[model samples]
Target: MSKFTSILARTFLQCRPMTNVSTKNMNMLSLMKSNSNPINRLAILSISDFNKRHKSSATSSLADKELATFLQDEIENETKSMETKATSPTFEGFNTELKDAKVILTKKSGKESFKVIFNVNNSLDNNSEEEYSEQKNVSDNKSNEDVELGSPISKPTYTIELEKNGQIMAFYCSFAEEGSYEDGNQSSPDSAGYSDLYRIDEISIYQNEYTDDSYSVTCDLLDEQMYEKLFNMLEDRGLGNEFASKLAEFSTAYEHKLYVNLLSKIKNFISS
Candidate 1:
């Protein structure tokens, strides 16, 4: 008989009724396997079925573990990217009012830079008349300065904070100076009509695991149009030969450092 038929015959014999009837036993005996006794064949078939079921379950468990690990790694990478993006400075869509303008020259790089702060006092003045009048003189002076310069100085100042591998290393401000027109001749200290100039201050670079060294870098003012053009070029394709050329035009070490830091952050984000 075929192996399938043999296994089936053995199962029927082993499961037959316990009652002893000579004629029934004779009839059942006719279904026995050709080579093996009924009991032995039945035992082999039961063991084989059990092994097949066990193997199928083990394979399923292994596949589940592999899938779980893959999902976990994907989640971790996504979380890191989100956190980095949250902390990093974005050039676009920034809005803040600039105030308290000052100029400084860095000795290390021999570059002149401007720094400014946000006009938070104005918001408070808007709510309180007394506060508004008290601060009016300061505001008037700033307005006069703007008017004398013949350009609206309403742009917001932004502070750039730098970090390496999730630790803040330095902070600096981008500022603008009002140009002066002396005796009908435009005689601004920075001959460039650009109101926006960035200055680097308060730098802290890590010297070791437990200590940090601080230094200040100077700023070199760039023409507003040239600055914008360079910014656009970098935005299109960041920090390559073309961008480097534009950066070279900036004579100040502080300016170079700011541009490099910004470029590095942008490149890392894009590649990620």
Candidate 2:
């Protein structure tokens, strides 16, 4: 018999006289004394199962505590790292407006006003070293200087609209990360003498607005000289190489801020 059964037997014998016990109660006691009896086996099995469950629950609780601590530390580190890495809120003389995933900037030049619109959703991508170096040139101002090469940065297809006397000329533009200015057109007389960054992909001239039926003229259809003139038209209005670099830095910083907020949400969920 096990030590527990032996102790049980001794306790029962010492607790009462054998002559006073009923026969049925004595039979039950006899069955309990045997390890092979179903009743006794069930009792032992139940105690073992209870101990295992208790141990598992304790281990799970400990793991949860450790995970919570790790998340908290990570949150703190990311928050501190981004404290000074905010994107510049102001972009020269333009009035800035943010709506969800889109950023709108508007500026007036003499009798003409222009709007630059870009979307942040699905715009971020890993940047090459050459492009990253170019982006750093305009980081001297109020925003996003901490982003390094090979990091995820904003590469958006944006739109610029120049309006004068109720007529609007819109340029659908993209950035050329590599080998765009090798044609010796970098010093084009119409250019703002800024670095070659922005590219005019398409141009559309509309009156009173853009409708579903409006036509867009692709830059590929235009000659090199015409394209250069169109590009310079935008550069003169402040959407030049410098603005391109600053906008990229701003977008990177903005995306990082969003990422940190997401991390914070995850941590809160786990802790809760």
Candidate 3:
């Protein structure tokens, strides 16, 4: 055999599986080679084997590419769904001013807490015939004039105060609630109950850090411009009237209670 033929045979023998079928094929090919030109025969065999292996590798690469594309699409869809869920607002409660309002708070070591405020609007229709009839009857009765109408109205306003170890340090009005509508119930014209309404104009948070004998406190409330923008938006969207006022009153009371509790906790922590 030629030197080139000898080298090709050795290379093929090392690479092919050592099986009876491969051995038979090798023997047959060797017998067909011309004694003087065995190099050509070996070249043909090498070419055929290379073509088969190249085709198999090409098919495997195509399948891998398809699988990768499918996986990529699934990952992208899941990421979009997670983002939507994170941004979507969830209703916190109902029948109160703070109801359906979203609250987000974040705090880090040595950093002040960050708060995001969400606007909440509630509406109720009172133009029904039944409601009109009731109001007409009350207006006609002189005895009902002195009786309280609707609900009590508290100032939809709040102040932020800093307390350390059970002592007040500073106080300031930071948030004020605005009424959407005046109470329309028939009652004494001068009675305060006729002015009851729920409104939550703004929310403010008081943050404090206490040491052994001293504390640092800060108050952050909604910006005036932002609050005005929100108020305008609600009005434009027809979120006015007595129902909105009542909601504001309830929310103010609830928020006040929450502030008190938070202050109490801080006092206890410092004392301990």
lDDT of each: 0.38, 0.75, 0.40
* Tens-digit per-residue lDDT, 141-198, candidate 1: 7875642211111222233333334343333333323342222211223346432233
Q: How close is candidate 2 to the true structure, as a TM-score?
A: 0.60
The residue-by-residue lDDT of candidate 3 on 1-272, one tens digit each, is 99999999999988997566687777775667553467877787799899999999899777766665655565554344334322322322222124333322222223222222223222112333345567556866967476323321223233222233444322221122233343321111233533313233333223353245553332224454554454444344333233244334444344334433444454444334
Q: What are the root-mean-square deviations of the candidates from the true structure over C-alphas? A: 23.2, 13.5, 23.5
- What is candidate 2's lDDT per residue for 1-272, written digit by digit as tens? 99999999999879876897899998867767777768777988799999999999899878877887887888787677577566554688889887757889898989999899988777775455356666556554537556443346677878989899999999888777544354433323344644566677788989979998889988777887777787677677778778887887877677667767777777677667
Ranking 1 against 3 by TM-score, winner: 3
Per-model clash counts, in order, read 2, 0, 9
Model 1 C-alpha lDDT versus the unseen true structure: 0.38
Tell me the deviation in Å of residue 234 in model 2.
1.0
TM-score of 1: 0.21
Model 2 regions more than 4 Å off: 1-74, 84-86, 128-150, 179-195, 269-272
After superposing candidate 3, which stretches have Cα over 4 Å from the reference?
1-26, 29-32, 35-38, 85-272
Clash pairs, model 2 backbone? none
Top candidate by TM-score: 2
The predicted structure with the larger lDDT, 1 or 3, is 3
> How many clashes does the backbone of model 1 have?
2
The per-residue C-alpha lDDT of model 3 at residue 204 equals 29
Residue 10 lDDT (model 3): 96
